[model samples]
Target: MTDDQAYAGTAEGQGPVQIDEELARHLDNKRTELFEEFEIRDTFPDDVLIEAKNATQDPEADIEEELESGDRVDCRDLTTCTIDPVDAQDFDDAISIERLDDGRYHLWVHIADVTHYVHPGSEMWEEAVKRGNTVYLPAYTIHMLPPVLAETVCSLVPNEDRLAHTVEMKIDPETLSYEEIDIYKSVIHSDERLTYKQAEKRLDDETAELHDELTLVHELADKLHEQRKEDGSLVLNPARDRAHTIIEECMLKANKAVTHELQWVRGLEAMFRVHPQPTPQEWDKALREIQELDGVSIPGDAWDDPRKAVNATLEQAPGRQLNKIQWAVMKVMPRAKYMSDPFGGHHALNFEIYGHFTSPIRRLSDLVNHWIIYQNEGPEDHDLAELCDHASARQKAGETCERLYKQFLQEVGLDPHAVNARGLEVVEDEEDAELTEEEADTESAELDL
Candidate 1:
C-alpha cells in the first residue's frame, strides 16, 4: 500500500489508526520485551520449589502447636478481621481492638509469621533475600516465596488457624499514647475478611456484621492519625477512604511498636525503613520552586514541621495540581530506605524508629524482622548493613518495574490525554491501510483531546 493509503484512516489524517486487537498484541509484545530486558524472574528455581514443597508437607509442621506453647498469647478469641484489596491472595495482616475496664483501647495487630517455615540458610530464605519483595504487576505478581507458602501455609486467610507475630498495644483513649506495648508470637483465627470497599460499607451501615468492632477500631485509628499529624508526620493525602485510613494507622503503630521493642528492650539490630529529613537548603530550594511555579507560598514552619508543611501547601494548591505539588516536594526530600542503624528515625513518619513488620509474605525485610522478633537472634552470618543495602536496591528495582509496566499500559489504553502526558511517541504501522471512517473519526477525536 502507498504511504497515503496507510495514513488515510488516522486522526484527521494526522495521527495513527486505532485497532483494539492490534494494540493488545503490541502491548503484549512490549510487556514480554520489558520483562526480559529488566530480567524480572517469573518463577522460583527448582531447588526453592522443592524445599518449599517439603516444608509444606512435613508431618511435624505444627505451627499452631508451637505458637500455643510459649509466651505466645492465644488471641484467637478476639473479634479479629482483615481488610485488604478485594483480589488479595495473601492476607498478611489482621487487626483487633478491645476496650479495657479503664476505657483504654487495647489494639492487637497480627502479621503472618512466614519465618516459621523459611529460616536462615534455607533455599526459601535465599530466594526471598534475592527477590526482596513481591513485584506486583497489573495482571500477575512475582512473589517472594513460592506459591505453596505464599498462598497457603503463610497466608493469614480467614477462619484458618495460623501462627503470627502479634503487636499488642494499650493506648489511653484520650491521648492515643501507648500505655503498654507487647510483641510476641501468637495464634489468631481471623473471624472475617473484608475488602476496603466492604469495610467502608460496614462503617456507613451500623447494621452490618462487625459494624461495632469496625467503628471502635476506626475511631481509635482516627485519634492515632491525629496524633501522627500533630507529631509532624508527612502525609501524602490521596483519595483514601475511611477503611484505608484505619488500616494505615493501625499498621503504622504496629510497625513503630515492633521497631521500638527490637531496638530498646532486646538491643537487637534489624533492618529499619528510614527516611532522612530534608536539610534547610533542600527545603528552601523546594519551597522556592513551588512558589515560582504555582505561586503558592509555604511557611517556614511547614519545613520545620512536616504536618504543617503538607497541610499548608495543600491548602494553597489547586485540587487538580495537588499530586504535581506533592511530587515536586518528594523530589526535594531524600528517599526512604532500609537502614541497619536503629537510632536513625523515619523522618517522614516522625518516629524515633520505624520498621516493616506487617507483611513478611511480601517483604524480606519484614521476614528478617520476624526472625529477630520470634527467634530473639539476628542473622549471625550476614552483614546487617549489606542486607539493608541489597534489600533497598531490590525494592527500588521492583517499584520501577511496576511503574514502567503501568505507564506502558496507559500509553496503549483508550486514554489519549494520558498517552500524550506520558510522552509516548506513536509509530506508524506500515502495512495496515484498511479502516472505517467511523474508526478514523473516533481516533481523531481521542487524539484531539
Candidate 2:
C-alpha cells in the first residue's frame, strides 16, 4: 500500500484550483516554513537527479538483457491491470487474479521493482534513505526518489514490459489463507490502467472490460475484509468501497506474506511494521467515550476487544458521529512505527507480522525491504535499527508537515481539499480567482480514517 493508503487518506485531485497571486504567495511561504520546520528536502541533489535521469534512459535494453539472461521471470501475458486514483501519476503496483480448476484462488501482486534501479551504494538509494518517505502536502509532493526515475522506469505503465517484484500466492477459498507464496523478480505487461471510479464501474457493468477480473477480486477482497474484522482486526473505515477494499486487502496480504517469510521462513532481519496496543485503561477511556456518544453503542461481546468494539460502533454509528468515534479511538492509540524486530505486531491492522513490500517508490522501509528480499540477506554494515528509527521519525514529520500545510491552506481562505483535488493555479487578476467558502464547504467531507 502507498503512504496515502496506509494513512487512510486520499491524495487524488480533479483539476487545478485557480487562485490569485497573493494567495499563491501565502501558500508557498507556508510550505517553505513547514519544510524548514520538518527538515524536508524538497529538491533532489544534482548527482541524484543525473543518476535518475540516466537510469531511465535505457531501461528497455537493460530489461531485455535481463530477460534473456533468465534472471527475471517473464509473466507478460498475465492479463494484468493497474488500478489507482484518477490523478495518480506513477503506478507503483498492479494485480492479476485467476481461479485454479481445483477451486483455490491464485493472486499475483506486481510491485514496481524500484531496487532494480535504486540499489545499495547508488546515489538514488542514498537520497531515498535521507528522505525516508515522500512528503505529500496539499498541492505539492516532495518525492522520496527523483521523479525522473520513479515515474518512468519504475512505473508499471500499461503496455510496457516493466521490471517488477511479483508476489504470487495460492490462496485457499475456505479460510482465505495462503496455501503457497512465491516472491521473485519478473517482467510484466499491464494490459490496462483503471482508476478507482473505473474499477467500480467495471464491477457494476457486466460488459465493461476487466469486469470479470474486478468482480472476482472484489469478491475475495470482501471475504478478506470480513475475515479481518472477525479475527479482531481494527477497521476504521467500515464503509470503504469495493475498489479500495480490493487494493487494501491484497496489499496487506502481500506485505504480511513477505514479512512472514523474512522472519519465520528465511530467519532474516528486516524492517517490520510494529504497532503496540494501548493499555487497558486507555482502551477503557476510549470505549467509555464511544459509549457516551448519542447514537453510538459498541456491541457487548466486542467490548472484550477494543479494536472490534470500535469497528462495530463505527459500522452502526451515525455518519456525523463517525469522525468523533474514530478520533476517540485514535486519541488513545499509539503511533505505529517501523522496527527491526517484529515481536510487537501491528495493532491497527491486527497482523502478526506486517511490513511494507508494495510501495518502494515512496517509502524507505519498503525500499529497504525490497533490497533485502532481493539480496536474500540483511543489509551488512548498516544499522537497521537506526534506519527504522529514522524512517519512523521522518514519517511522523511528513504527517505533521501535511497537517500544518492543510491548516495553513484553511487559514489562507483556500480549501486544502480543493487545492489537493484541483491543483493550484495562479491567476493574473482577483476577478479570476476561483476558491470560495461555498466551494470549500461543498468539498468538505469527513476523512475516512
Specify the highest-TM-score model's number: 2
lDDT of 1 by residue, 24-132 (tens): 5776686677667666667799999999988888422475457546766788898899987654678899999988999999999999878878999998998898888
The Cα error of candidate 2 at residue 212, in Å, is 0.2
> Global lDDT of each model?
0.75, 0.84
**Local error of candidate 1 at residue 420 (angstroms):** 21
Give TM-scores for every candidate, taking all chains together and pairing residue i with residue i: 0.83, 0.94
Clashing pairs in 2: 13-421, 14-421, 15-422, 16-423, 17-423
Q: Residues 1-449, candidate 2, lDDT per residue (tens digit)?
A: 63213312333433467899888888888888888999999899899989888878888898998899998999998999988866566788999999999989899999999988888888988899999998878668898989876677788888889999999999999999999999999999999887787688789989877899999998898998899889988887778789988998888888888988899999988889898989999999999999999987888988888888888888898988887888888898888889999888888878887888899988999999999998987666579999999999999999999988887777777787667656677999999888744344322122211
Worst 10 residues of 2 by lDDT: 440-449
